[model samples]
Target: MTASQPTPASAATLDAQDPLRHFRERFHLPPGPDGQPSVYLCGNSLGLLPKAARAAVEQEFAAWERLGVEGHFHEPSMWMHYHETLAAATARLVGARPLEVVVMNNLTTNLHLLLISFYRPTVTRYKVLMEGGAFPSDQYALESQVRLHGLAPEEAIVELVPRPGEHTLRTEDIEAKIRELGASLATIILGGVNYYTGQAFDMAAITKAGHAVGATVGFDLAHAAGNLELHLHDWDVDFACWCTYKYLNSGPGGTSGVYVHERFANRPDLPRLAGWWGHDPSERFQMKKGFRPMPGAAGWQLSNAQIFPMAIHRAALALVDEAGGMAALRRKSEQLTGYLEALLRGLNLPATMLEIITPADPAARGCQLSVLVHRNGRALFEHLAQQGIIADWREPNVIRLAPVPLYNSFQDVQRAGAAIENWVAQAE
Candidate 1:
């Protein structure tokens, strides 16, 4: 059956029937200069603030004032066990066991830490395989890691790029490359979703292929953790990390999360750069000479949790759990994004003017749609901004629009589409 054309009335009907419609009220949308709520479609960059985040942080402040240092062991919320508060929800979001996940340092720091253990290199099998255009920080991290081990990145890092005339990598091509580099490949790490193209890779298949060749596999889930329905445990991913600022709805520069497969949780031989907080909690206060790592993902921690960021994390995660987890969010996301895509297609802009770089298949993408604006791209972006449409732009030409299922409404998508069509018409 042919899909109906997306219209304002149709969008309103969808919003009215949305089971998660009430969730829009849960976020504090950014306002324009006129004090009106702007059309926010950049959740893929930074999520809207949860209404409860301020209160949650203030609660921690009150506890700190009332108990001082004693807050570490006081009732209500103890600072000592703060990381534990968000573990279950975080685990649920990423599809992992509670023991496999932990909230800790920022994203790249955790990646370096994980690479220390998982990116084990030897004389014969030391090369790392990754996407060619991985987020710059990852490219830097992997290159520096190889150099840290006295290996030249040009010789040790194999980057996989899309085929000619392609915007994203093909899974079969990725697996084929893994097979080709079988013996020399020591590790495989990729973004769970490509930040620039918004393509969600086949992580499970990739992991299976990497394992077949004796390579440890991991993912940088900066865009996928909350946007995609991930199964890090089921996918048998060796290690993974993500920052909570984006789709996780934890504020800007929020606490990051790490996951280590259960298979390596108790491996005493696994080398890690640890600190006092990662020592066995029972003897953590003993000031012992030996550094016996704690079991599970917690063992990788280097310090105590950041309570303020975590308090915000707790509040944001509660909303995810309340909305019935990733399953419910994914359902709404598909429809809302599908509607937006249809609207963009209806614009019928010529290839020379604009093109959607993100994959057309819903299974291969999340909430983001990256539009490549060919003529006067930045000026067109500015035009949208002047219309109170808060979107993100990449250098060169890409305009990224993300319709967040948790807070963004169908009307917002409609407005964004109409605004884009109108802008293009005026520019011409």
Candidate 2:
């Protein structure tokens, strides 16, 4: 029920013993007024820039300067097959086969593309089931997709929400809803981790339940990709898409990744909107007539690789891989987040002041802890921001702080706690 409240010395001790402590030096941290690195805990919203990203980008710039029109093939990292280079690392990140994954367009774009292929609505099976309070972009995309199919958004989409007073959805409730929707469920798409409450859903369980109802299953891994340990293939997830900007640390508007289960990968008969890049590479340049789709998830590509962003993405993923992949990072993440929660609990603020909306069980969440600031939430958020503690505030009243395993230290978490304690004392 209680942890040994983290002290300055204890935080230092944890940092000293941390195997991934060296990783903190690999990112470019924004400095506070005193010129010290600010306590950054906003990774769930946007990750800090990796130190290697600049140099990787510069290398590509140099290739472009020298080769001009020939750079597509002559560059060292060869732009022609650049997406392929990212395939393995990305597949490893989400626990999928290389062919099942492809680094391509942004998150929402890929989601629409995947929907075009997967959301096959019929007279009987024409409804989608998703978690309520999903990210706004996902909500808009789902609505638009439904409307495009000559269906009303309200009727074609079903959203699962928590019980009256609860903050997060229960797995049993989700499965029960899926079973209830059985024959009419066309596809099930939900955030692998809910962005609002920081609740990491039971993805494998959800996938199983959706499949049992004869519904296609997919996930938006925006909050899950680099924050949680995902096994998409083993979970039998049909398809998935995620942006690289957030937990993946690939900068804002970074290239995204998509996964199509291998069973669908080899099937060209699957209906999808196509483009020249998605065509087979063999006769791709021959000015082909009919669209001969490439095998695997790459078949969904609509444009050339966004080379600049992909370069930074490569730099960021290298850090994840070097840290012994997601398994090791997740181990550190649990401890770091637990430390943050302990520090917050030790504050002993009034229940009206701050309440953690995220699931209390570590297994049900990722690195983020979404705290509901009941009163003066915005003022408190501003205070923390001015104090050089970088966290994010959501509309109405939630403050999200993510102690990223790759860069954030226990001391950073300590400073953030101290800032909160100081602010709450002054306010109350």
Candidate 3:
């Protein structure tokens, strides 16, 4: 039941037999300046760079140097519609039709773009429903959008708080709030996965509940898009957005994607910021003053894609697809994260002193484990970092360790757990 019994070398033997073990070789993992590998458990913050990403990006750069203007149409990967090329793979990752997805700007920017279209609010129904402790960027975006609608954020937004002493939100409480908010609800935008806690919400059920009350439902899928199983189209989610830099392994500030259901396709009435890229391919060069929005999510594009970022994103996604997409990844994620949880529980650590804020159910979360450091959380995290265990630290007491199934092995999780226990012992 415990991981401590296994010799560290046994982990290498286990990794040798792992079906997805070869994936680690595809990434150029972080190394100390001295060229030693850093124990990277921070895929939720920034993913390790895929070797293919480097190669793919280099092809584009090489083309640019040799072909100049010809790179747009003659390049191996066309920049003229670069983001379009990525749509197919992204759609598969998020469970949407290819036409329903488009790779474009960064995460926060994409969220703001989606909000402009979906967050229509009338005086009677101007409330934005969200979890109380959403990522600061999400909270800021919602508040700014509310103010743009000519209402005070305090009056226009409704945040759902967990009851006293609870770390996670209850589904029943969320549904009750939707029922109670009733007519005042304009849009429901939520994190598809809670960032700090790594909790994956029930997208289908929430979408259904929101639609029942005439609210348009959307999600910011920063943590869930690739780390968890998603069917945004099947869930009937109106729209969703996520960055590729995290679980997608596309490196920092990599291209992000947005999903607009097929129902919204060709619906010219939907508000969107415009550019030549969103214009019809042939007509884009027509230089006609009138705008002609393309069909599906491509119409939401504001500018041509970033070729290097899109190339990197494509390379990373190929790794996910090669591993048999989310189906295989999710199955392994359950086991890997479950194994980590088991190791933590075996430490016999008191729940009062340390805690896992993430949901216990595999159905409700992804591969990341968000641990609350009971005492001297920041110092403990610093100590772990010094030990070459790279996890992300949030204010207060949270340290998020995501053992990405695509590249991380059970051995990595075991070492991370051991590091945490050792750090705790040192503190004592």
Candidate 4:
């Protein structure tokens, strides 16, 4: 890769040829001072709301207003089984059968619950292996789970840190540790795609390696779910959890989902925190004495679900399904993100001043590029935000720019590059 003139018009041509361009109109992008739509590239943090989400939420509101408590089951939206409506679509997106999926609580909460079942620590094998720089919330959950098991947090929770002076963890390094610790590993809970570096780990390979030594494998797919193509069931993942707000475009704090493999599909007898929702739908109203887990992932549910957020997820997933699912999204994502990488490399910026930590291979990453700016990083990021090129910045350093397949375009990438160039010039 070498520096060359960034022809914005050629980038614009790429945007015009994009098949997913029409989907951008379905969103309401923020407007700038010139009253033009903003170039939103921060879909990795929170996604733009689909216009359909508005109607879906309003329908639920209207149904509640008209039917009152009757809305629970009698309303037009039929809240009784509202979650089920989104299950199949969400399942299809994650490559799981309807029975293998569950639309449940938020990400961390679900992670804790899944840990309760999967993290069965024992005398000989009782440790959770994860990436060192995992999201704070996940690390906190791991610490708490370790403490709850009556073990020292530091000993029970082992973070597979990157090699010295390296920013990203490598696949070979991870497998080496797994091979060494897999026998004594109770559960292997890793992020599907790293949140900070935008590195997508090989889920199938990771799962297979972990299972070879009798370890329960799971993933916190907050970064991978809709952003990357995943076959959770096929990978034989013990469990997985994700929020729908990022690439799924379901809005902030939108409904989350989980996957339990078909191996556990019919084992309704598995120990879990059972609520009325997990009881047999047929005998649910009977106030059953014994807990009968639903045939699949739904068996993990507890109590009533969030209907409004679930409806938004339903509308958002329809867009995902219509866009030809994760396979198609991933295809465009590779070229589109590669275009951004190409443009970034074309800049004559100094390596000492700026760095792209994301992997060059599309198979090893999603659409995110974690850019590290050595000079005035935060200010430069704020400047880009003021320019309406939405991207997320973590404290200290790192800006995650995600060119989402659904709405983001090549023009957005070019606009971002131009803004960063201007920032560099100003600093100079």
Candidate 5:
């Protein structure tokens, strides 16, 4: 069907038939200006709170209250091994083996830890390649990492920018760049989904290209983990890290997830920053002088689990499992995003005023559709807020709207479209 053909009645019909529509009630949607639920299309920034999260957190509090320090070994849940509970579900979410995944520190911290082992640089093969506009945290981490190795950031870091006037990078161009960097490319790291443009890269192809050139391949899945159907193990990703607060619906500053390929599971030769918790549990209590790391991704843990955030994470992951995993979510995500695209395009706004910068091909993007506003951009964003359409506005020009399948309804998309249309009408 054409972008202009979907009407409000059609939207209702589609919502009614949606198998996942009932999942919307599982979240707590923020109220709009009218004191009703807002059209929340901003999961790309921060997801709505899962209704189950409160009970999960209370369970942890109750355990601590009853057992004190002994809660580390108590029933119902054990603080010492709490992170283990998340490993299997997280593995399934990202298509990795349970042994290869762990829930631990915040995103950038995990990235730095993974890079310590993966981004080993030699005098000749010292350059790192990444997408030009990576999220600021990734950029900062890379720059500081290179300096730690006593290499100049300018000489050791390479960023790939799109061709003239392009909003996103092409897969072929990325592959070409990898080949161009060749043996000098010590590591390849990019956001699995570009945060600004909402472009999802071909990770398997990218991993293959990086390995072909003797480079370690990793991804900052901060925007991709819960938003995309990932297969990190099949793709041979060396390492990856992501925050759980966005699409995963964990609370703000939720603990991050890490994946270290199983090949590194027992590679004690790999250099890493170790802590007491990461020590082999059998020997951990012995308080030995040497750090004998545990096998698998669990070995990357620097401290014991962050109980409060992890409680919420466990709760959020249950919702994903109950919804039949990412395969089911991805199917609905494509349709929900497509419906929003249709509604926006149907407005027929002048290109000078509004532009959908996100890739049109569903396979090349996530649920986010980045709208670039040329004139009165902030005004338009304010109009959206006033009209009860919650979206994310990037500095300068872009506004990002994500119709998350787990909670957002088709009616939310209709309201967003109407809000933008009203803004245009008033401006005219």
Candidate 6:
């Protein structure tokens, strides 16, 4: 082995010295076909369940059985204000003030709502800019939004494509595109992390560029919220949204989170599809005819709190806080992903057989490393599954492995590396 290549012993040593190693016990790792614990590396798609999640859900169930409608006003997590409980923790996760963030509707729903206000396209500036090959939902949302304005998508939607022979978009190219769109750009929204390529965009730079062009800026942080260190308020991001089922470990089809900068908190002039829940709580029970929005992100809510999912989400966020928040988690994540990258590089497989498509710079990505398998990709994925390695397979040819810092250990990375090496050996 080369001096740079990590060995099984080195992996074990790293795990032994890891400060966050104990967090692995907090999650219930999925069992492999062989019935042993699988090296679960699919957190980028769906995170593993936190052991505390069951009790959290049960608490809500008990509240319903005992309290009925009274539960909305009762102590110990009142359903009426349950969403408020998550505000501070959610804010910390994304680097925003508590008032700037709110736990709300699912990701796309929130995106559409935020668009109702932010994507106010006028005759002179009707264009929206996004990355090429964004997650399909984002593509559809932007296309539909353009149509809603009676504009042809082909003319109003500008997608930033990577240069020929490149697998990812460059920051310089993105900034230049913003400049090229200039006065015509009314809104700019991109994934905080590209779901397929696992590339974390330069959000701060993108936000600044968008504002310079007099455009509103936002992000779909579905792949980035718990995976990266964000500063939404400081970055002057106009708005953003993310789902909880991925790295947040809030169960399937969990609720989403939204961020609206404090500057818009009192802007009743902003267009939104108002609902009873968003009406000023001071007068909410008045059965009022006039709509008065609550200040800050909470005003964006269109429905009552999703109690059960919020319970699970509440438990999950506690674990993140106990694990020392994103700054500490990111320190471990960089090391863990760097180790995985080094191991893959050590394989020395031919480009025709395998290639790592995720960015090499750790700053440009989160925990996800998307492997582009050029030959028998599905077969390789199945091989890993049989070997007790759980990873995600994207259509056409990519396999995404995310070693989440909250629960994954260094040994898991070693096992994934060994499994890939075994596949190459068997293929030869």
Error of 2 at 352 (Å): 2.2
Model 1's alpha-carbon lDDT is 0.93
lDDT of 1 by residue, 1-428 (tens): 12346999888888888999999999998886567899999999999999999999999999999999899999778999989888899899999999999999899999999999998899999999999988999999999999999999999999999999888999999999999999999999999999999999999999999999999999999999889899999999999999999999998998999999999888868998988888899999989898898899999999988999999999999999999999999989988889899999999888889999999999999999999988998988898898889999998899999999999989999999998999888987
- Model 5 residue runs over 4 Å out of place are 1-4
Model 4 agreement with the true structure over 1-428: per-residue lDDT tens digits: 22224578777677677787898888878786467888888888898989999999899999988998789888578888887887888788888888889898899988988888889899999988999989998999999988888999888888888888778888888888889996688899999999999999998988989998899999999999889988888888889999989988888888789998888878865667788998889999998598888888888888788988888888889998888899888888887788788877877688789889898888899999999888788998899978887788997888889999888877788898888888887888
Worst 10 residues of 6 by lDDT: 1-10
Give stretches of model 4 more than 4 Å off: 1-6
Candidate 3: where is the Cα deviation over 4 Å?
1-14, 32-35
Give the per-residue lDDT of model 2 (tens digit) for 329-376. 999899999999998999887778899999989999999999999999
Q: Candidate 4: worst 10 consecutive residues by lDDT?
A: 1-10
TM-score of every model versus the real structure: 0.98, 0.98, 0.96, 0.96, 0.98, 0.98
User: Which residue runs does candidate 6 get wrong by more than 4 Å?
Assistant: 1-5
* Model 3 C-alpha lDDT per residue in residues 1-428, reported as the tens digit of each score: 12334446656666666788888888877774347777788989898988887789889989899889888988486678677778888889999999999998888898888899999999799998998889999999999998888999998889988789988888888888999998889999999899988888888988988999999999999999789889999999999999888999887878889999999998888887788888888888878897889999888888877888888888888889899999988887887788778777777878777889999999999898899978788987887777777899998889898888877887887777788789778767
State the lDDT at 52 in candidate 5.
94
Candidate 6 lDDT for residue 282: 90
State the local distance difference test value for candidate 3: 0.86
Least accurate 10 contiguous residues by lDDT in model 5: 1-10
